[model samples]
Target: MKKTVKILSLFLIVLTVMISCKKDTDPADKDFFVGTYKGSVSYNKSGQSITSSDGRVTVSKIGETYSFYFGNNIPDITGVKFEKSGDNNYVSVGSGLTGITINASSLKMLVNKDGATWTADCSR
Candidate 1:
């Protein structure tokens, strides 16, 4: 059954190729961003805003979700899930009142709630 043997060989080759192929993955998907960053911070409320260059932030992952903790007790934002937004960049998904955009070297945050706002431009 030479024809049967040939068909089996082709099927095996196709299976090997399918098994060896890899999916496109981003570095941010591989825990490249779990760390601490420090830079500028700003907060505004009721027509008054305070700014400083001493901001600090820590990023942690539990399972597949990420959490952002800010210095000065700014209230940690939790349960944020990120999706790849660009080259080395990630943005939060389905988060209310808090939004973050981050790359390998920098992060920016904007939060608005109850007539108050907070923003940070930070870097590792």
Candidate 2:
């Protein structure tokens, strides 16, 4: 009984870690997302809240910006502007989720977390 209990605890711990640390992702077959996009977002670290609702994505040859909203009643952006960087990376600066993928299309993206980046996908 004790041995079984110990194994169960270990399994639970490993499962929790696996579920919590799921951030890395590759794009699906039909995703059109690439580049680093900056959205107007600020998290209240103290309270752990999302303060902003909308952010910008790069739109085109003229360097114009478009809005990609995370809140309700707002439309997802179309014709966003994006720029390529040194190696498989891009940046569109304006708001939150600043570093997005510009080379491929997918539901998930990467956001800068200090030195490393976090993966985030668009959910529709």
Candidate 3:
């Protein structure tokens, strides 16, 4: 009876530990943000600029890289990488002053690279 009690207690302790543990998930491993967002989007390079109020930005992921397909004839932003930020956000990784924050419901971008600027405020 003592041996049975010890075994049962050990099983209960292990089960409690497993139940309390949380799994850490990587955002890049899934396409949670891979969809089309619609709102305002703009792009500027040199002296030319393009803006649209009814714009769309499609998010796609291939491996660890992400691409942003913009509407309104704006050039697409490709080869972008992101790191997980906060609990449910992914922010772009780059050396420049690029800021692209993405979540399951929204996408915001103010990226400037290679003398070009892209701005977006969109939601799925």
Candidate 4:
């Protein structure tokens, strides 16, 4: 019984360490990025048939809970989460994520609904 208790204690300690490491490794401040981003995307399937739209995407950051949205008539889309990997690098997450890339001069991504990722240059 004593040996089993020691093993359990060690396991708990390892788990706590892992959780702390995860939090520390997320090395980006996702606070300043919450805003309405305007851009456009190109859609093509087989040939050069494509359509582009000037749409708006909004991001709201309330502490650790980040909510995102994008749409045409109404911004009904939500839960566009991102994991910031570098100084200006990110990717989307949710039921299905379309990659979003942000930089000093470019705010582009192939939206989740699109057949492919489209990059539309935007301004703050």
Candidate 5:
């Protein structure tokens, strides 16, 4: 009986340690910065300009990267990479991309392609 008790105790201790040390992800980790945001948007191409106050941008995770779909005549941005810039902020990383910043409350985009510029300040 004592041998059985010792084995049981050892199993419980190992179980406790395994449970305590197991890696766990926070709520923020599962978020993946996916959401829809809306605000102001402006696009300028070939001397033609368009602006709107009800701009929208939807963010989603595709594989390992994020996709940005913009509204209000702004072009959609895809396959862009971002890295953590602050406590809840991320900045885009790539060439020919001026800047992209995302946070818990807002998403700002500024990119120029083929002399066309698209900018948006969105929130969710």
Candidate 6:
């Protein structure tokens, strides 16, 4: 009976430790940055422009690619790759003039690609 009690205690201790411990998540991971931000957003393409002061951008990630889904009928920017920029920030991998910066609380984008320009200054 004493041996059985010791084994049960050991199992309980191990179970408690396992339950208390959590895996460390990297800030650059998709789960850290996927959310919705609201603010101004604009898009211009081929002389047509759309702007909204109450715009929203929903960020989603799949594998290594991140997508920005713009509200107000603005076109979505999909399959963009980002590189870690700081402790908790990621920036789009592209030319210096047009890129995106994203963190836990904010997102800023100024991208011009394929004759379309998209701008956003949003925060959660």
Best by TM-score: 3
Q: By TM-score, is 3 or 4 better?
A: 3
lDDT of each structure? 0.69, 0.40, 0.79, 0.52, 0.71, 0.77
lDDT of 1 by residue, 1-124 (tens): 9999999999997775443322232326554335676888777777676677897877666556777787875666777777777677888777374478876677788877677777889876
lDDT of 4 by residue, 15-107 (tens): 754543342233135343345566664544444434346765555554544454554433233455666666766666666555665544445
TM-score of each: 0.63, 0.27, 0.72, 0.45, 0.68, 0.71
Candidate 4 weakest lDDT stretch, 10 residues? 19-28
Q: For model 1, where is the 10-residue window of minimal lDDT?
A: 18-27
Off by over 4 Å in 4: 1-33, 41-53, 103-105, 113-121
Residue-level lDDT of model 6, residues 1-124, one tens digit each, is 9999999999997775444322332325533335678899999999999999989998776577778898888988887878887688888885533489987677899898888899999887
Show model 6 residue runs off by greater than 4 Å: 1-27, 31-33, 94-98
- Clash-forming residue pairs, model 5: none
Judge candidate 3 at residue 41 and give its lDDT.
97
By TM-score, the better pick of 4 and 6 is 6
Alpha-carbon error at 91 in model 1, in Å?
0.9
Question: Sorted on TM-score, highest at the top, how do the candidates line up?
Answer: 3, 6, 5, 1, 4, 2
> Superposing every Cα of model 6 onto the true structure, what RMSD results?
9.7
Evaluation by lDDT, superior candidate among 2 and 4: 4
TM accuracy, model 3: 0.72
> Order of all candidates by lDDT, from best down to worst?
3, 6, 5, 1, 4, 2
